[model samples]
Target: MTNSKKFALVTGSSNGIGRAIAENCAARGFNVLLVALPEPKLEEVTNALAAKYPNQEFHCLGVNLMDAGAPQEVFQWCQKNNFVVDILANNAGLGNSGDFLSKKAEFYFGQMQLNMVAMVMLTHHFLPEMQKLDKAYILNVASMASYYDIPFKGIYAASKKFVSSFSHSLRYELKDSNVFVSILCPAAVLTNPEVIKRDANMGFVSKITRQTAEQVAEYALSRMFNRKPVSIPGVFPKFYRTLGRVIPHRMQLRMLANAFIKQSRE
Candidate 1:
């Protein structure tokens, strides 16, 4: 039997921004389906949310989204369980920073698979069901890096660019439908110890623009629910995105290259 309750299915919900988003969804009275890698952390998060939101349903599946057919597997699992996912949060992604050629080809491929392919495929799988709902939402977590081509993070940035482009185009196509698509482009989210330490080394812009996972989650969900096309959590990131528009492409690329190169050395 199909579950009558609507769910918000969140990818990467074991930790960081994804976890924060999941908590928010539960708070807003939506049942949550948390998806992350198979690990104790995933179990912990699922248990924690279940305890915290006793009235709402909280289920989890541990799966590595980068694997082939993983998106389909997730869809199948939801189907078998009769979970009706009205809100799909594509928040799982891999972000690595280094010279383009420094990483092995396999690493880049896997990054692309997780960051771009998995997101697209998952959306493809869930979009039809979303369209059937009275109202639905797709929140894609991209990065402010999507607006620029950074030197050390070329592949990661490019993949996010793909996300940004794809999301906007999808939103256009779904404009007349019940499904609403929005993208969150946050800058320097301090989600963990490593991210906090990295933000310290990221200079003034990153520091000023940085946000906590909770902050990003709150802002993103608020804006997404309001049907905003793009949600930028911080003021500086919003300003920087606008600034990039007037700057010549060559100059912007050069500036970004220099900044990332310096950060890479630090």
Candidate 2:
């Protein structure tokens, strides 16, 4: 209320999909709080957005969204600065690709930390404030993995599944509260190079029907602003999800495994 412009907060917004979402939100007339780790790369993105969206205001938070203190810290920062967030986009996520037993439990926990836990924490902390307002939106960036299990990315798939389910149930829970939740599930997106480095198997996926970060952001935010419950951004992903109903799970898993193997080689 202190600032005349409506507010939105995007997590892990230094680059890739998160950064695109932050820029999209700003273009949509919402001042954005760009959250990322304390790094020069994060600062660089902040400076670029500030310059590009000169008409809109943006705040940068350098706290780890996966940390225990992140949710409270973000809330306090907003309150101190008198920024009222009408929209919250939970976009920060980490990938896990390896044999389940071979990988440490810490890796699985880290997936939950970024994908599931951080999202829940931020939503819990912000929902009360959002409910107070007459109109508000919450967008959770899930993945195509939400509906299926990735063979090597077992934990990553599970984490996204949590995000998809949690957002759906919470959407119903808050139905009468006037705070709508949008769960965005997009297929393989080739953005942050970190993913390619983390799992060399992702290289071949570049040839697949992958979406760009900007495309995902544009479509997702447009539908979210309209209060859509579930959004499948691109044409290919929506088609795949529909066809996946008839595709056997075993075959689906096999195809994904082969794709990973190909990426690794590339």
Candidate 3:
């Protein structure tokens, strides 16, 4: 039964890394359910994937995951459609780039809900079904900021840190189960023109560490299927993660602040 039902549910599948992951899953012959807001991009991606992978089924659900009830709605939709999800990719996230004080509390809190709460809710609802499968996987998309206490991007960093920690603990807890859980931490992915412009402004380190969405997705899924607990997408980001651990805390803070200053100048 499990082998017969190879459906993957990917949140935020309209664009960026989410789109890449969805495309990858379809290429691997998995029926994909693309979830995102009710936007034109959602249908666009669904149609494109359907056209590209004619044999593999592709469906789209346009809903705002930020709504507290969204997780249940997604689960019910799967039930109604007879989709047995074997893979759950929680890729939807939000972040603010500037100083925390620049935005209202609602803005920051909304990001928290989307980045952390919605992810947790989706995982909570989907993990049980995944556990029933003979083989399954859960891939969460975190960020490089997950490793640090960033200044201007404080809330965003904290949210990603929660994701990183939650994924690690969940993986360990489900170690005995058939389902494999992995978290991807990638830095400066070239997802769109705006992101490219932003990364360009972040200086040499950002440029060198940046990866394409396809690149990140390919490497992340490979490592996920291999049952790796964590995946850091680029050589530089991995090295940077390791180096951050060894560096003194205060020094790290100062360095990050300085980097932020340099980025501001750019």
Identify the candidate with maximal TM-score: 1
Clashing pairs in 1: none
Q: Rank the candidates by TM-score, best first.
A: 1, 3, 2
> Once model 2 is optimally superposed onto the true structure by TM-score, how far is the C-alpha of residue 186 displaced, in angstroms?
1.4
lDDT of 2: 0.82
Lowest summed lDDT window (length 10), candidate 1: 257-266
lDDT of 1 at 60: 93
Sort by lDDT, top down from the best: 1, 3, 2
Which regions in candidate 2 have their CA more than 4 angstroms from the true location? 1-5, 194-208, 261-266
Candidate 1 per-residue lDDT, tens place, 194-227, comes to 5666677777978899898889999999999999
After the best TM-score superposition of candidate 3, give how far the Cα of residue 111 lies from its true spot, in angstroms: 0.6
* Candidate 3 per-residue lDDT over residues 67-111, each given as its tens digit: 889989998898777788889999998866666577798887778
Model 2 lDDT per residue over 79-136, tens place: 7877788889999898766556766887677668888888999999888888889899
Model 1 TM-score, all chains together: 0.96
Provide TM-scores for the models. 0.96, 0.91, 0.95
- lDDT on C-alpha atoms for all candidate structures: 0.90, 0.82, 0.87
- Model 1: lDDT of residue 109: 91
